[model samples]
Target: MTHDLVIRGGTIVDGTGAAPYDGDVAIDGTEIVAVGNVSSNGKREIDATGHIVTPGFIDGHTHLDAQIAWDPMVTPSTQHGVTTVLLGNCGVTFAPCKPEHREKLAGMMETVEDIPKHAIMSGLSWDWDQYGDYLDYIEKSKPAVNVVGLVGHCAIRYYVMGDRAVDELASDEEIEQMAQLVDNAVKAGAIGFSTSRVEGHRIPDGRPVPGTFSSEEELCRFAEIVRDNGGGLMQTVL
Candidate 1:
């Protein structure tokens, strides 16, 4: 049988807890057609002599949400062989933002993650105001890597409480609003939500990010929101 492509004689590490082996891999379009001993000819062939062929890496935590807009390949992460990345980590992200709130979110990401504030501000198109729309924007940009996103509490809190988010616990109504926003994000495409409680992760004014001082009741409310959504990843930094 003829295949679309074949890689011959590479050391294969397939990431299945299997031992390394020298073999041939044949591909038909996007799918792997054969492995081990592929005797069929291919439309294109690569001599993988003295090389390694392995599955692409997955990075579960990355802050490439802003960078993806300007750098579709997402830079160093892709250079290191990662093909999939999870964005909106560490309770910092650029969505669920009001137009007036864009600068605040950008500044907070810079404070905690050291991403350049100017780059974030100027680089992105700033088209979306919600987490799901942010994801849609990411897709529209056509990044080289597959992207997964987690809705972030910092953005949620800021969107709801503005500057007071850093210092005050959310009001009952604010918490409910936050829950509704998170539910909308998940329904749109978010796999989960994230927040930070560690003292070190603070915004530009040296205040802790919004979720850092969350009361148990507040945390439980968020948990319930995700639970009712059939469960989702809750990434909290502590």
Candidate 2:
């Protein structure tokens, strides 16, 4: 049977963190059907003689959450051969935010991540208010690379506790509410939870990010949500 594409005569670096090998790659539709001496017929072929072919790299730390809405391909990262990217790092994200809190989130991102507030404000569509809706927006956005998200602690706190999240510890009731929000985000396809306890992360108003003030109990409660989910991980900067 004829294949969709064939990449012939190249050094294949099979992403096992091992050494490279000389070979050819065969592709059918979206999958790499073969990676060795591929002698199959194909509709199209790329002459990769003397070139190197490797599985696409993944960027584990990316802040394109806001940028993705406007630049789905994620530009420079994709241009540099990163075919997958993980976003929502340093406890910043745009989901789980109310309309009134949009600027707050933008300001936090600007101050902490050094992403310009005007860029986020002008670029993001801001049509979604829930974590699940944010995922849906990303799916419909059709980014060139695969994108995975982590539920941001700051976003969760801001969503459930509003302004009080910045400097105060959650009460029993608030902790439970925050836990539920994180659980929901994990179930909705977040790969994990992220937070920043670093003193440098603050809002433009000079208040530390809500996650920075979160008690250990609050953090552990959210971590439990990820642990129970069976495949999530925790990423934080303390």
Candidate 3:
């Protein structure tokens, strides 16, 4: 059978963090059909001699949540060969937000990530109000690279507890509610929960983020939820 594409004579740096080797890789449609001495008649061929062929890299940290709505390639990261990115760090995210909270979230991102609020405001589409809905919205987008996201504690807190999440400690009842929200997000495909307490992140109103004042008990409870879920990573800036 004829292959759809063939990469001939390349140094394949298979991303095992190991050394490189010379080989040929073959592709059938979107999947890599074969590797090593791939003898195939192909419609397209790449002369990859002296070039490196490896699995795409992932950016562990990036604030491309808003930018991905407008620019899916993520610019410099893509240029540098990052094919995947994880967003929603330092306790900020655009997901699980109401339309009325667009500016509020944008301001938080701008202040925490140094991205301009106008840039976020001009670029993003605030059309989703739940974590799952937000993921669906972005999935429909034409992304040049794959994107995975975390549910930010600040956003979840804001969505659940509203304005009170910032100034007040979460009551026992509120903490349980927040835990449920996080649980829902994880089941819906959020990678995990992220929160910030670095004293550096402040909202436009000059207030620390909601999770900044979150007690150790609150954060530990969220972490427990993540651990129980079988797949979640907590990112805290403290």
lDDT tens readout by residue for model 1, 1-238: 8899999999999999999999999999879878899999999999998999888899998988899988998899889889999998988988799998899999999999998899999998898888888988999899998899999998998888998888998889999999999989988988888989889998888888888988888888888878889998988888
lDDT of 1 at 137: 90
Worst 10 residues of 2 by lDDT: 206-215
**Which residues of candidate 2, in runs, are more than 4 Å off?**
none
lDDT of 2 by residue, 1-238 (tens): 7789999889999988888888888898899999989878779999998998999999999899988888888899988889999989989989888998999999899899899999998887788877988999888889999999998989999988888989888998999998898888889899999999898888998878987977889988988889999968799888
* Model 3 TM-score (2 dp): 0.93
TM-score to native of every candidate shown: 0.96, 0.96, 0.93
For all candidates in order, the CA lDDT equals: 0.90, 0.89, 0.86
> At residue 161, what lDDT does model 3 achieve?
82
For model 3, what is the error of residue 181's alpha carbon versus the real structure, in angstroms, after optimal superposition? 1.3
lDDT of 3 by residue, 74-122 (tens): 7988898899899888889887887777888898998888899999888
Count backbone clashes in candidate 2: 0
Q: Which regions of candidate 3 are displaced past 4 Å?
A: none
Full candidate order by lDDT, most accurate first: 1, 2, 3
